[model samples]
Target chain A: MITPELLLQELQTAFSKHKYGAEPGELYAPIGYIMSLGGKRFRPLLTLLSASIYTDEWQSALRPAMAVEVFHNFTLMHDDIMDNAPLRRGEPTVHEKWNANTAILSGDVMLIRAYDLLLGIRPELMGKVLARFNQTAAEVCEGQQLDMNFEKRWDVTEAEYLNMIRLKTSVLLGFALELGGLLTGADEASLQLLYAAGENMGMGFQLKDDLLDVFGDPAKFGKQVGGDIISNKKTFLLIEALSRAEGTYRTDLEYWINAADFDKNEKVQAVTKIYEALDIRTFTEQKIREYFEKGLNALEGLPAPDGRKIPLWQFVHQLVERDK
Target chain B: MITPELLLQELQTAFSKHKYGAEPGELYAPIGYIMSLGGKRFRPLLTLLSASIYTDEWQSALRPAMAVEVFHNFTLMHDDIMDNAPLRRGEPTVHEKWNANTAILSGDVMLIRAYDLLLGIRPELMGKVLARFNQTAAEVCEGQQLDMNFEKRWDVTEAEYLNMIRLKTSVLLGFALELGGLLTGADEASLQLLYAAGENMGMGFQLKDDLLDVFGDPAKFGKQVGGDIISNKKTFLLIEALSRAEGTYRTDLEYWINAADFDKNEKVQAVTKIYEALDIRTFTEQKIREYFEKGLNALEGLPAPDGRKIPLWQFVHQLVERDK
Candidate 1:
């Protein structure tokens, strides 16, 4: 089987081969712009690697793998509009670069294009694939809505937050792996295991993101170390701390959260101190480890041989070990 | 084969059978809301009627036919946001009823649901149907973009306007007919003919809408007659008048277009008089006739017996004859 590195190169070539640009420059420009402003291409790579475990014909999964990536960007484009976010990947968002209407319309086209990308997969698989995609797409939206709904409330629970992330962030990752398996005709049990693996890994990845936001070296993280704390963004650490904080810890968190004016660093420092007092770091790390272990076990449970599973195994290690 | 009237009832029943309501009512309530604020179920009716042309198995097309209706409402929901229109079907628009973010997210789900509706069709037909739906959906976006682009320019030509309307309003109608034929395993030629017939009829329908807005009786039209004139909206008559006017006629047309303030009735009267002077009504009627006849011709050329085609023929007459 081709290594993950080589499969990624092929994925790049596949992406370049499919142009998002078309007439009515306004509608298509942002699609091309966002696709060009690349991320890790993490989801598609996972898809290809997941397929690599089953067959050497994993190259055919590249285009369908892109469906996940395109759909990911589509959600981001709309989510940015909802969040009224100014920057994405350290640059202006589609809504900011153009306008909300442009972002909304362009994001819409990106979604339709995602469906277009799925067309050439095995015809028999198309119906099931489409059904899964539709369900995931709806869940993502529901997740966003729940996330938004949480914003207006002060009592968001850890369970609620985790489920939100699973729906909003993790399900697509799960779908990515499931799609690859589906395309390769992986057995029912295997597909389920693959999806569970990705979903668990995704949970670990999101919690890692939470940990990095408050704890990682800013230079390596490439973002403010305690930005979420400063913004009082409800994250795993915050939720855990909120759930566990007692007496002064609770008072300080609420104080900073409700403060009308305070130094950004001071608020972040205070929040960090409270999280430490609450053992939030250890708590979050333990949760992250649990998920990562569950993910590893799912991968182990796959019917593929240890040799065939080695690449995916390595990729998951790399995923969980990322500092930023 | 079932009659169009019965097909419509079946379509309504099918629509009710599939609830848009789900958890995270925030993301779904708008879907149910918009679908419930119903209008003429014209597109899906054409789908079923077109299928009736081919076989008695047209009843099998009901669920798939709902796809076009769902897709049509999806466009309207998003377009309502982009146009900043406060009302749809005489009710508050989704964005107005909830919020823009709700509208955007709910609209996204609606589009995905449309894909879900298409999934249970013949497995072989799923791909072609999806491809066509994707293409049509993109054209609708492009057309809306062009329409928005025209908003900033006075130089938009009659041809540009026609093409834009064809993309925006006509193709989906064409797709509706084509989708029904496709679901019935209609031959390639019949599919093409069905699409073209629907496309031409769509053009006529849009033109007739343009004509009715300015000329139809207010009570009958269920909207303010001359509302388009009041807004200076670019339509068949206006585009034709803009292209054909010369000398004093040009001055009057330009004056009305540029006027910052004018009495609504007076402006409507003046524009109507100018249209009469320039023969814009006759001009628009001629264009409408051309399209409707082309649609009729396409229908007549279909390889179906005349008796079997009569329901579709009668339906087209009803569509063209609508005063509103």
Candidate 2:
């Protein structure tokens, strides 16, 4: 009967309770600081909710749930440093408040703290839990490397970009839910299905982020619209436009892409025009919907699924359909 | 009866065998590549030697020993990036060969691989093993952060710098020996003494490094002498020199320290003259020997002490007394 909002609230409270205490404060305070910046907490909440569907005492999953949150924030702290980003969630990043070295060292400790939190899971499941976590951790690193690699090359394909995001972003989501199921002693089939569901939803969610960067209402988006477009970041719409554009349109797109100095508004407008000409946004939307459908289908495949799953499903649907 | 040389060779072979076979070889290859560069493998060899003193099957400690090696290299990879050092053990650093981004990612995966190796230890002892490893990991980060913080301030005290190096450099040595002892199920008291021994010895080893920078015979040092003095680094001698110098001597020392551009050799020679006048080298050597003696006392206190402990002690003694 719990709504997604309620689940998220519970997760937020749990995360706060486990917040780094005074002695290790320097090492872990940034983790609490970053997590309290009001992230979606979607991944950890999915862990708790998925565990709830199988077991009554979802509270047992709290520590492991925090592990996911800690791991996510750890990655974010380091990623912001690498990206030289000044702001995250419309606020100063950890490296901005603290130095990059502090951010890097603190992020490293946060990852270790994640492992410490994960060690609290039932001893019987420790091996499986650690194995899955290790794989997810490595994949996350691989995804990051690929994302960085993408920045150097001009010819990144749509499939390559998708795979990079899937590995870097979606796989963690998949592991978050799969971890919940494993902790709850769910059957192998159920665990696999849940992982697939989370992953598909994650793909859809990222696609939505890319779309919102350009098409979203600025008021609703909570940040600058077309930020990615101005940066000439290779998003799905841009990649599709690159692949499908012809002679004259292609030349214009190339000019905009290569131009080091141009009116930001003018460049965004011109690129948006090309995307419209190619129906790139429509194509991206269709792909997003396809993955959203796949995620829902995976959820549907669960045997005798509890009614409690509806709130999460509805939340995801709302996410996909959101303009921001 | 194993010499440090023989133990080092075995440690190298074991480290080389652990495949860091993650994709994007250019990114993850640095992990294996750096380990392959080989810096005597001193820490892991100490672990094996400590274990051998307790039990004959030191081979049982190989994985945990390798854990120490991997962890040490992980810190080096990240530290080189932070220090902006172009060389490691006379070879191009991971960041130099690949890039900072790749080095960061590869260093991350190396930490994961360290855990993977730690996981290979006997399951019954895994908790104590991981707990020690976690504590060591956090301390290492704390030390690195403190070292970075010290760089911004000129008032860094000798005690503060020593504490930083102890945390930054020595705790891992303590943990390595402690882990080896724990894996062999040595008595708790013996493990404690062994850890203390390693820690005190590590501190002495660091002091020796500081001493060698100024006082070492160039033929034995393998690099230009007084490199630390030339860089105006706050080593033990420099700190002592600053604390003890009076009037003209203090002003001259401050001048060299504050100078923007000066002959490197002249600065080193000027600092060396001040240090000689103050007998700071003799003072530092006395302090180093005191720690070495304390380390020996701790080693002698171990329960059911074995003769094998003698060679290990002798090896560490040799490290301290060596010109290099």
Candidate 3:
């Protein structure tokens, strides 16, 4: 079986080979631009990893695996327009680079292209895979809507937030693994286990993102640390802070959140101080650990023999351990 | 085999039974709203009619037929956003009724749901159907992008305008027929004939739309006639007039097109006179007739018996005869 690094290299090679540039330059150019501005290729790597656990012919999964990556980027393109986000991965978003109409239409094409890639799946498994994909794709939209709705409301519950993240981020991760399992001829039980494993890992992964936003080293995080606090983004930490803060803490946090004009660093620092007093960091870290353990348990419960699961287990750990 | 009328009735019943409403009412309500606002249901009717040409299992094609309608509405939802149009089918568009973000997200979900409906295809034919659907879906987006691109340029050629309408409006019509053929176990040769017939018919259909926009009787048209003239929409007639007009005719047409503000009725009258002077109406009618003949020729070339093909042929003629 290929190591995770080698599989990732292979995914990149496949993406680089897949030309997004086509006629109607207005539509395809932005698609090519976004696909070229590469990300970690993390979801596709998980797909390939999951496939390797069942078969040596994991290379067969590459095209379908790339489908997950393309769909992920498609979502990012449209979400950026809705969010009014100017930058993505330190580069201008599709909407910013071109315009929202281009982004929306190009994103729609990317989605169609993703479905095109899924056509590479074996015919016997195609229906099941597509059904799963459609369900996941709709759930992701639902999740985005929920996330947007939470923006207007102040009383977002932790359970609601977790479900939102699961739908928004985690489900695709789970679908990636499940798709791999289905393609590699994994039994239903094993596929369920793979989905659960990925879903749990995804939950932990999002929490890690929440923690990194507020507390991680800025250089290592590769983004503006405390961006969440600065924007009062309703992340797990902020939601927890809102839920747990007492009189003075609540009043102070509210002041910063509602402040129309203030020093960015000062607001971030003040919110960080509030988080510290409430012990939100520790609380979030513990929650992350719990989800990761649940993920590990799911992995152990997989029907695959212990040896076959070892590489995936190790790769997932290394993934979650990334400082950024 | 189901008659086109019976099949259409069945299709309507099927649509009425299928629910678009789901959780996240913000996302789904617009979807339900748009789906409920009745169009002619022309595309899916063609699907059912085409299916009846191949097999007695025409009823089996109803769900996949609805897929085409749903996908068509999805494009309209997004295109209305790009066009910033407020009305569709005499009703407020999704974006106007709700918001652009809601319309966009709902349209995305609508596309996913279209795929879900297509999954009703038999497993053996699933990949082929999905591949075709994705290809058609992408071409539709490319067409819309080209249409938007044309809005910024005044030098669009007649050929370019035709191709744009082909991409934006025609291919899906072809795909609708082809999807019906595929679902009914039509042979490849028959499917190709069905597709060509639909494509040519779509070209004619769009040209008729262009003609109706400027010239149709207002009572029969059911829409505001001269809308294309008022908006200076670069339709086939306008493109041809731009290409053919000379001297004073050219200057008058150009003046109307470039006018910052003008009386709506006066502009419409002037453009109508220019269209008459340049004989563009006759030229456009000639083109529409040519396309309809091409579509009929393809239908005649089908491997199916003359008897089996008669209903589809009659259905096509009836569809093209619509005044509104």
Candidate 4:
């Protein structure tokens, strides 16, 4: 079996060697820059790892894996515009670096290019793969729309939040694994298990991100802790805190949420106090663990031998276990 | 042989009956609105016409024909956002009726949905068709970028202007025809001829539009006769006039172009005089005729019976022969 590190190295090398496109420098430059910004490449890595579980030719999955990465960055490029975010991966976002119009057009091309990459699949599988991709792509857009909708309303339920994230974030992960399995000639049952493993792990991954944004070491997290709290973001923790906080606890949380002007540090600290009282940190951790275990159970049930599955398990653990 | 009118009617009914999507009213409403706005359905009609040239079952091409239409509107939605265009087909553009973010997200889904329509193609032809669609799609974006670039440039040449429109407007028409031929199992040489006919006719169609914008009778034109001149849009007449005008005419043309503020009608009159002085109308008309004839010749070269070819011939002539 290829080691996880080798697989990632292979992925990075192939990615660096590939070019998006050039010309009409305005439309193509931002696409190249965003691809070069280099997020975790976690989606592509999952794609390769999933393929490895079925066959030794993991290297063959590289281009389709890059398709997932490109599609993800395309969403980020557009989402940054919608969210009015100025930064990504500690760098200026595409819209910030170029402009919104350039980002919009470039993002559109990236999506077309993603479909182009999938065209490399064997003809018999191409239509099936594209059908699934279209479904996933539409779901991601729906997820984004729902997330934006939540911004105006204060009464969003936890189920709604989970569903929103599942559509926006998790389904692509599911498709990534499913695509890998499809490419490797895995049976239908194995493909379902692969998709389930990725989906559950993606949920854990997102929940862990929510936890880290509040409780992680600021230096280790690579961003300001409590940003979601500061921005009044409707993350899982905030949804739970709102539903469970009562009396003075509810009053305090509401006060911070409604505050238009205050010392940022003071508000974060006060909210952290309420979260501590509610035991929200431990609660979130427990939920994250549950999702991780669920994903692991799915991985365990796959028909592949344990030796072939170990790399995938290690990778999932690495994603979820990032510095509590 | 199906007449052009019958082919167009069939395309319209199939398109009207085919829905984009529903739910998340914000995300889908604008899509439905734009699709329903009723531009001539020209692209899809050309697709059906091209299919009928080679086979009697042109009805089989309807879904993929709608794919071309959907992709065309998807570009218009995002381009309206980029151009800040307020209207399309005399109705509020998607971005104007809904917000830009709505337009962006919905436009993204429209593209994915276009690919979904293509999934109905036979498996053997799916990859080739998609590959061509990607190329055509990328060129269209490139064309849009070039057009935007021209806005800031005072020295755009006529050649550059034609190339830009060819990329922006002609290739999709080419692909629309080419896709029909591909669907009907037309041989590769005939597909090229079909593509050429649509492309050349598209060039003529755009040049005719440029011509009518300056020279068409105001009551019949359906738009301001000299809107291009008032806006100093770099159309064929202006580009040719710039290259050929001399002395007082050159100075006058430059003054109007550089004028910060002026009466719209006065500017239009001044530029129209300069275009007439250079005989640009005759020049533009000649170019339009050349392209139309070139397209007709390609259509004539098709191995199909002359009876089968006449409808396509008449359609190309109608598109380029518009007086309004």
Candidate 5:
């Protein structure tokens, strides 16, 4: 009965009511701004949905759920600086809008604020909650480090790349779900299942991001497709293409990747063509299915009856099935 | 029976044994690198010394003591990027050695690792400990932001400068001492005293740093004098001098400050003469003494007998009385 729409409304209310800090507007304003920018609130949504499995008062999980969102935006705000990104959600990045120093300092505070929010749960849960969160948080940093390391090298294996994404993007999602369940006082077995499902689902979600960047419909995708291709970002599709491509395919892919000057559209077209020849899309789809099935299977193991879990199921399914 | 030298040796051993992270060398090596760069270890030394006042097994507080050290270094790593400083302790900074992104990410993990180290304390203490640490961490970030805000303004007041340094530099030192006492099961009233004492001590320590930058001898100071004056950095002295100077004094000070081109020694000497005319050094020394006395007075309130606290008292006096 706890729908994603209801979760979204409660999250917006919580975020607005929350005051990050009062001093030095430069440090706290960006946190409110980024949280307001509102990128689907997927992690928090997942948290509330998971919390619903154990209690009807899923709304109680809102603050910790917001912690996941705050942590996510913290990474994005900092990552934008690392990637030298100009726009996020079609707005100037925190660094671009303010300055890199503001972004860095502000982002640092947001990370702490996330921990502050995490502290809102029951006292008995503090030890477990903090330990798990610390682990996930460190892994996210490690994941980002690996992604940065992969930037200069073309020899990055798929395993290394997957581990990077798993650590960077996926673990938090897992933590989000696990946190909700833990807060709701779900048994250990159920919490484990929830974490596994959320983590695998996160991998699926990221890979879907990779696919949609190339193959998603322009009208539906909202953003331009082939952005990953144009940038030669080391996404799942690109990694797969690099691994499978040989001779002519390899030559064309490498040429565009290294091209100092070329039309962006042409690079996209050429790379998409090379990817097509390598059946990278199908390979990506299979990987996506594999992850989704793994996640769904874990979710199925939960004791909550199918009737009670419909909304959460549909929410995750929408992520998997969407083209955008 | 506890000695400062014994504390330093234990701290160094703890730092050497600590493993920040593994796998991605780029992400974690800088943690080891910056920590190894080793400033005076003042904060950790304070923590362990504070612990000694409460328990003979002060060595048990080593992990949390290192937590203070780690948190301090985390700030340095990120602040180096914000300040765009190239050197930390006369060696290249983390960002200079590994780049800004690495510094940012590694600094983040260091912050979390600080919390992880805090977890080494008892479970029952987690809530109070995390809440206090969170407040201190956020305040530190706020202080850095204010420091950054001061960069462009000549209107910065002495009070504003003190608050900034207090937030930026003092609170963590306070927390470091307070944390050691908390870990060793100090009573509520005593813990409060330790925090106030350490915080004020930190203020004195920083004020001394500002004073030493201008007045300390080059042979003993180990770094150049008047570096703050040369940069027109809005430290306590500059703020005071700017406020107090009038007529001919103001005119002469403005000449050195605004002169786009001048010999470094000429600038230093001109600034020093202006400061001498304004009696700035005495004002700075008086302020430093005020803070040191405030701290020492609080330390006096602790139940520990005078003999048992000799090491702690001498350690503080050494900081107060040092030429450098």
Candidate 6:
């Protein structure tokens, strides 16, 4: 059985070989530049791995796998412009490196490129794949909108936050796995199980992200620990604290939330203290575990689970348990 | 025969009937709102009208026609966000009225809905229609990127600007008309001619916009006339003046181009004088008429030399001759 790392390397190799348009340097150049800024290549790797469990020739899923990566990058390019983010993966974002308008236009073309890639799927399965992709894309946009909307509202509930992240982050994971199953001619029942597993695991991953934002080691995380707290971002911890805090605790939380200026350590310490008092960390950890368990159960329920399924499950477990 | 007004009315009627999802109030509300803020509706109307040229039941083309309109609006919503423009058709732009993130998400859904409307197209023709639509969509993005690139360059040529506008604006118009022909099962030759006609006419239309931006009466033109002049945007006239101006005129043009703040009217007047001295208006008029003639020739070149072609040509002529 191939390790996830080996699968990822194979996908990356395939991606690097796919040629976009040759001319129109303004358009294709940025695409190549962004794709070159390698992350884990997790999405496409998962796609291939999911296909591998059902079929020996997972390379048949490569085009669809590329679709996922292209779509993912398209969103990132546009999101960076909207967020006014200067860097991505510690490198200048497309907008910052090129320009906002170029980023916008390039991102738009990347979306078309995704559809072009999807067109390579078997004609018999094209409609279902496109329908699924359409839903996933719209959900991603909705999730982004909700994330932005949450910024202006002080009353965002934990459930609402979870739903937003689920939409924004989890649906693609679901689609990635489901697309692989579809490509492998898996039955609808098994496809559903895979989708549910991906969604549950995705939620667990996001919750872990929130946990890491507050409690992660800065060196390992490659960013400031408690960065979300510093930004007054409404994460799971803050939402829980906001929902469960008492009079003085609520006031203290609100003070930190509304404060114009304060010592960074003091603010982080105060929020951490409040979160501990409310038992928010423990509550979040329990929720994360629950989601992971649910995801694993769903994976186990897949009809005629292959021997390689254990490694896939282990891959997700490792993701959920990561400190960073 | 339906007048352009009746065609536009039909489009609005069809557009209004769409019951977008459960969050219909907020999600789909913007579609109606923007559609209500009426522009010429020329693109979709042309689509419907072109379809009518072959079949009397142009009503059958309503959904695809609406797709064109919806797709147009989707581009506008995102473009407004990118341009940071505050107005559309003399009303507050979506981003200005709501926020950037909402506009982005709403725009994303609008694109999805465009596809949804397109799915109503006959299954046999769906692939062809989507392929054309996808190609046009990507070209539009490419054109927009080129336009943005032009902003930073001091040496953008007139030809480059024309090509940019051709891609950004004209290709969609060509696709719009060609889509009409495609839906009606017109011969490929006729469809190609229709596309060429629309492309030529569209170039003429955009060149007229550049002309009107400076030369048209302020009230008649809707927006502030010469707004482009004040911004020193590299319009056809400015590019011509920059290329042709000798000694003092060249120096003065460069000075105005570099000027930080000056009397708006004076600057407009000075640039207008330079353009007049170069006979840039006449030059642009000749170019516009050349394209219009080419468009007419293409329309005449259509497989069927039916009398109805005269009215269609007349409709295009009327559009070109409009003051506003």
Please list the residue runs of candidate 6 whose C-alpha ends up more than 4 Å from where it truly belongs after superposition. Answer: A1-3, A19-28, A53-57, A217-220, A258-261, A305-314, B1-5, B19-32, B53-60, B217-219, B251-270, B305-314
Candidate 2, residues A118-222: lDDT per residue as tens digits?
766665677678778888888888888888888888888999999988988999998998988899899999889999988998899899889889988988988
Candidate 3 — which residues are off by over 4 angstroms?
Answer: none
**Global lDDT of each candidate:** 0.90, 0.83, 0.90, 0.88, 0.88, 0.82
CAPRI quality of model 3: high
Error of 3 at A254 (Å): 1.4
Q: For candidate 4, write residues B178-251 as lDDT tens digits.
A: 88899989898999998998899889989999989988998898988898898888998988988898999999
Residue by residue across B1-324, what tens digits does model 1's lDDT show?
456788888888878777875889899999999999988899999999988888887878877788889989999999999999999989999999999999999999999988888878888888888889999999999999899889888889988999999999999999999988899888999999999999999999999999999889887898889989999898888888888899998998899899999999999999999999988898888989999999999999999899989889989988877777
Error at A108, model 5, angstroms:
0.7
Position B220, candidate 2: lDDT:
85
Q: What are the clashing pairs of model 4?
A: none
TM-score list, all predictions: 0.99, 0.93, 0.98, 0.98, 0.97, 0.90
Q: Flag clash pairs in model 6.
A: none
Fraction of native Cα contacts reproduced by each candidate: 0.92, 0.33, 0.85, 0.85, 0.79, 0.29
| Winner on lDDT (2 vs 3) | 3
Report the error of model 1 at residue A249, Å: 1.5
Interface RMSD of each: 0.7, 2.0, 0.7, 0.8, 1.0, 2.7
TM-score per model for chain B alone?
Answer: 0.97, 0.96, 0.97, 0.97, 0.97, 0.95
Colliding residue pairs in candidate 2: none
Task: Write the residue-wise lDDT of candidate 6 on B170-234 in tens digits.
Answer: 99999998999999899999999999999999999999999999999887988878899899887
Better of 2 and 3 by DockQ: 3
In model 4 chain B, the worst 10-residue window by lDDT is: B15-24
RMSD of each: 1.1, 2.5, 1.2, 1.4, 1.6, 3.1
Model 1 error, position A91 (Å): 1.0
Poorest stretch of ten by lDDT in candidate 3 chain A: A305-314
